[model samples]
Target: MFNKKYTIVKNEEVIPGHRLMCLNAPEIASRAAPGQFLHLRCGDGQDPILRRPLSIHFADRGRVYILYRIAGRGTSRLALMARGDIVDVMGPLGRGFTLPAPGERVAVVGGGIGAAPLFFLLKKIGKIYGKKKDMVRVFLGASTLAMVPGAAQIRKMGFPLDIAADDGSGDFKGTVVDMFRKEAKNLALDRVYACGPPPMIRALAGAVGPDPAVEVSVEERMGCGVGACLSCACKVRAGEGEGFGYARVCTDGPVFDLRKLVL
Candidate 1:
C-alpha cells in the first residue's frame, strides 16, 4: 500500500450524479487489482476529517480511475474539483477478490454504484478469459436502465450481459438475485462474485449457499484507511466452530469468501 499525492487527470460524468475521475498515480495503479479501493482526502482537510473510500474502477499504465456518485458534502466537494487539482490518495489497500481460475465461468453481479469496481474486474478478467466462449457474464442491477453501467460497451468487448431493474425499466424486471435464480441453470455459472449494498450482499450469500467458490465485496463507513484505527469493522462468519467475528473492511477485506461472510 502507498500513500501518495496524485493529480486529477480528468473527470467526466458517465451518468447523472456519477462521475468517473482518473488520477495520475503510477505506483498505485501499477499494482492495483480489481475489488481493491483507495481512500481519498476531500478538499484539503476540511470537515469530515475521515477520508472517503472509493473502489478502483479501472487502472492503466500510469492512471487509476474511480467512479462515484455525489451523495453528500464530501462527494459534492469532489465533484467540484477541477482536472488539474491534486489530492491525497492511499491505496491499493485491502484484500481484493480472487480471480476465477482458468476454464471456469465467472459470473459477476453488480447493483447501483456497486458496478463501479466491477468495471475494472471485467476489463482485466475479460481480456484474459473472454477468448474462451461463455467465460464471463455480467449481471447489473439498477433502478432503471440509466443507472446501470454501459451495457452496450460491455457487450462490445465480447462479454455477455444481463440487466435487472426494480421498476421494469430496462431488461429483466426484478432484483439481480431473482434474475440469477432464474438464469443460473442455463448459464452454467461455475463461480459467483458480487459487490453492492449490504442487503443485496446478505441475500446473495444466502442464494450462493454453502458454496466455497463464491466471493463478495463488502462496503462500510470508514475512518482510518489502514487497519490500525479499527473503524471499518464488518461482521463475517468464521470457520466451522469459530462463529462470527469482526473484520476490518478497510484492510482485512473489502472482499471475502461468501461462505465465510456473516452477512
Candidate 2:
C-alpha cells in the first residue's frame, strides 16, 4: 500500500450527485486489484480529519478511476476538485475478490453506489475471461436508473445486464436480490459476487446459503486505512464451534465470502 499524491486527470459529474474522477497514479493503478479501495484526503487541510475511503472504480496501466456519491463533507470536497488538482491517497489496500477461472460462469450483483467498485472487476473479467455475454451476467440495483453508477458503461461493454429500481424507473420493478433469486438458477451461475447495503448483503447471504462460491465486498467507516485504528472491525463466522470473530475491514478484507460474514 502506497501513500502518494495523484493528479486528477478527469473529475466530472457523471449523474446528479455522483461524480467520476480519474487519477494518474501508475503505481497504485498497476498494483490495484478488484474490490480494493483508496483512502483519500479530500482537501488540503484537515477540516475533515479522517480521510474518506473510496473504492477503485476501475484501473488501467497508469490511471485509476473513482466513482463516488457526494454524500457528505468529504465527498462534497472531492466533487469540488478539478482535472489538475492533486489529492492525497493511500491504497489498493484490503483483500479483493477472487477471480474466476476462464471456464467458470460468473455473476455480479451491485446496488446504488456499491456498483462502482464492480466496474474494475468486470473490466478484469472481460480481459481475463473474454467478454462473451454468456460467460458473465450483471445485475445492478438503485432507486432509479439515474442513481445506478456504471450502467451505461456496462451496457457499452456488452455484458448481459439486468437492472432493478426501487421506484420502478429501471428494467425491473423489485429489489435486485428478488430478481437474482428468480434468475440465478436459470443462468447456471457458478460463482457470485456482490457489493451493496447491509440489508441487501444480508438478504443475499440468506438466499445463497453458506457457500464459498458467493463473496462480497463490504463498506465500513475507517479511521486509519492501514488497520491501526481498529475502526473498521466486522464480525465473521469463525468455525463449526468457534462462533464468531472480528476482522478488520481495512487490512483483513473489504472482500469476504458472504457465508463467512456475520452480516
Candidate 3:
C-alpha cells in the first residue's frame, strides 16, 4: 500500500446525495484490483481524524474513481472538494475478489453503493476472459430508482444487466437478491460475487448456503486503514475445534468467502 496525495480530476454528483470522484493516481490505479479499497483522509484538517474507506469504483489509465454517498460529516466534507484539489489517500489496500476459472460462468452482484467495486471487477474479467465475456452477468439493486448509482454507466458497458428496486421503481419490483434467486437457475452460474449492506449479504449467504464459489465484499466501521488498529473486525467461522474468530477487514479482507462469513 502507498500513501500519497492525488489530484482530483473529476468530482460530480451522479445521483442526489451520491458523488463520484476521480483522482489522478496512476501508481495506485495501475496496481489496484477489484474489491480493494482506498482510505481517504477526507481533508487536510484534523476534525475528521479517521480516514473513510471507499471501494475502488473503477480504475482506468492513470485514474481511480470512488463512488460515495453523503451520509455524514466526513462524506459531506469530501463532497465539497472540487476538481484540481488534492487529497491524502492510502491504497490499493486489502484483498480483492478471486477471479473465476476460464469457461466458468459467473454472476456479479451488487446492491446500492456496494456496486462500486464490481465495475472494476467486470472490466478486469473482460480483459482476462476476452470472448468469454458472455459467461458473465450483472445484477444491481437499490431501494429506489433514484438511489441506484452507476446504472447508466453499467448499462453503457453492454453486459447483460438485471436491475431491482425495492419500491418497484426499476426493471424488477423487489430486492436484488430476490431477483437473483428467481433467475439464478436460468443463469446457471458457476460462481457469484456480491457486496452490499450486512442484511443483504447475510441473506445472500443463506441463499447460496455452503457454496464455496460465492464470495462477498464486506464493509465495517474502520479506524486505521491498515491492520494496526484492529478496528474493522469481522466475525468468521473457525475450523473444527474453534468456534469463531475475528478477521480484520482492513488487511485480512474486505473480501471473503460468503460461506465462511459469520454474518
Tens-place lDDT digits, model 1, residues 207-241: 66443378788888898888988888988776777
TM-score of each prediction: 0.95, 0.96, 0.96
lDDT of 2 at 181: 79
lDDT of 3 by residue, 1-263 (tens): 89999999989999888999999999998899999999999898889888999999999899999999898989999999999999999998999999878788888889999898998888887877777677888889998988887777766665678889999988899989888888787766789999999988977876654433998999999988789989899999999644899999999889998877787
How good is model 2 by TM-score? 0.96
**Model 3: pairs clashing at backbone N, Cα or C within 3 Å:** none
Q: What is the lDDT of every predicted structure here?
A: 0.85, 0.88, 0.88
User: Tens-digit lDDT track for model 2 on 1-263?
Assistant: 89999999999999899999999999998899999999999898879878998999999989999999999999999999998999999988888999988878788999888899999998888877764656898999988877888888888887889999989998899888887877786767789999998989988886764332998998889989898999999998987865999999998889998877886
Candidate 2: C-alpha lDDT: 0.88
True-structure RMSD, every candidate: 1.5, 1.4, 1.4
Deviation in Å, model 2, residue 261 alpha carbon: 0.7
Cα lDDT for residue 101, model 1?
Answer: 75
Winner on TM-score (1 vs 3): 3
lDDT of model number 1: 0.85
